[model samples]
Target: MLQRKLAALLILLPSSLSLTVTAQQQTPSNPVAPSQLALALPATASLSTEESHKPAFESSSAEGVIRITPAPQLEKELPSQRPFRTAAFGIKANTLGAGAELATPLFGRFNLRSGVNFLAFAYPFGIDGVNYNANLHFKSSQSTLDWFPGGHAFHISPGILYSKNTVSSAATVPAGQNFTLGDQSFINSVGDPVHGNMSLAYPRTLSPMLLLGFGNILPRNSRRLSVPMEFGVAYTGAATINVNLTGTACTNDGCTSFGGNSEVQASLTQEIHKINEDLKKVPVYPILSLGVAYHF
Candidate 1:
């Protein structure tokens, strides 16, 4: 019985050994490394801790590739887009008179300006022994185109001046007092003073004007107020003088009608010619002004 049992045990041991050899042959000889394992797996199998916690705007593809896209940035503003101030109004004091003005922008570095001026006063003087009360009056309207060459406060202006200016006088001579008109000397008739009227005026009412100035009525920046100053001239042409007399006068001979006297008329014509000749020397009227203005 011992010999039989030994035989059966040897057969079963051989069969188990054969099965173990077969399983060992089917298995791999070397284990895979972590790096190799990762390459072997699908691309979406895993993600890094840092990549998993990224912001929504940043993203990673299923291929394990990172595609970071930056957010859009805001745009900046431009100077031309700023609000434009349209007009300005102001008061001024000038050689012509006290006045007010309006200014408006026309285009880049250009402006339009318009204003009016007025002044009236009296002066007393004596010419050729004639006591005269003279009234000087000034009224004018002007318009100009202002140009800023370097986009600065300094500007040049060309314009027109429409004037209603006059110099009028009342002439008188004391009764029996001597006076000269033209080249003739005469005496006022006793009980009758030599009374007359004289007027000086420009031949042209519209004159061309040119100006150079500092400061601007409408500033380009954020300022709301400015002080403007200007110096210029207007070509007004020669002035004309007229004289009329309505009183009695006496020459060496005798008293006669002052208005009807041929000698008196001739003298008056000569005097007028002389006055006009002097005026022709100065055909331009001066302009100077300073002002405060507000812009809107």
Candidate 2:
């Protein structure tokens, strides 16, 4: 039995040695020395350190490769904001317009406006006179001024006015009687007249006013509109004070005043003086008006 076992061992030992030598011949060479191997060992161990600092993605097909990006860092700062602005503009009677201010700037927030107001029946009136009973006329003029302020739409404007007021004075004096112009036989003081003369003359008046104002602001979507009325007194006259009233009714002749002899001549002379005195004394009257306006 011992001899047989020794024989089997010899055969297996030779086969094993041959297998070892063939494996050694098939293996590839190491290119590194002992010191190079030590250096290479550290480089291999440092792979974990490189991976910790890297972007954490790899081309290799690993078993469990997870990617995570930490929450973004947010800044802690205040936001930006802007402020509001004031407003400025002008308007006319019942519309937005530009006009000259006959009066100066008052109340800081107040402004005077002068423009044409083309509205029928806006200011209608009739007057009875000596020659004409009642003259009826339609007044539409080109000269008028308005004054007011932005707040509450309250304003006051006083300037020259050219309006026509007519009345009718047609009647018979009932066959010679002491009936004056006011007598019912001559001209009744009731309604307007039909066929009468209307004159475009200067009249003095104070215009206190109220209005509706509208406005718009672009940069900021803001709007303002209001209806405001105001009452005040004004005098329409010249800033300078100077009077000159003297004239004669000369028929196609180089005028000459025939002294204080002729009653007609004296009456006419005194009439002109009276007119001068009236113009000298300023008329302070109350005024009230209502209108609409727009602001932009």
Cα lDDT, all candidates = 0.85, 0.35
Pairs clashing in candidate 1?
none
Least accurate 10 contiguous residues by lDDT in model 1: 76-85
Native-referenced Cα lDDT, model 2: 0.35
lDDT of 2 by residue, 226-263 (tens): 33333444343421221121222222232333232254
Look at candidate 1 and tell me the lDDT of residue 94: 93
Residue 158 in candidate 2, Cα distance off native in Å: 8.6
TM-score of 1: 0.69
TM-scores of all models?
Answer: 0.69, 0.30
lDDT of 1 by residue, 55-152 (tens): 77666666665657877897643222233447889899998899999988877788899999999999999878888899999999999999999888
Instruction: Please estimate how well model 1 matches the true structure, expressed as its whole-model Cα lDDT.
Output: 0.85
Model 2 stretches with alpha carbons more than 4 Å out = 1-114, 118-225, 232-235, 238-261, 271-280, 283-287
Candidate closest to the true structure, highest lDDT = 1
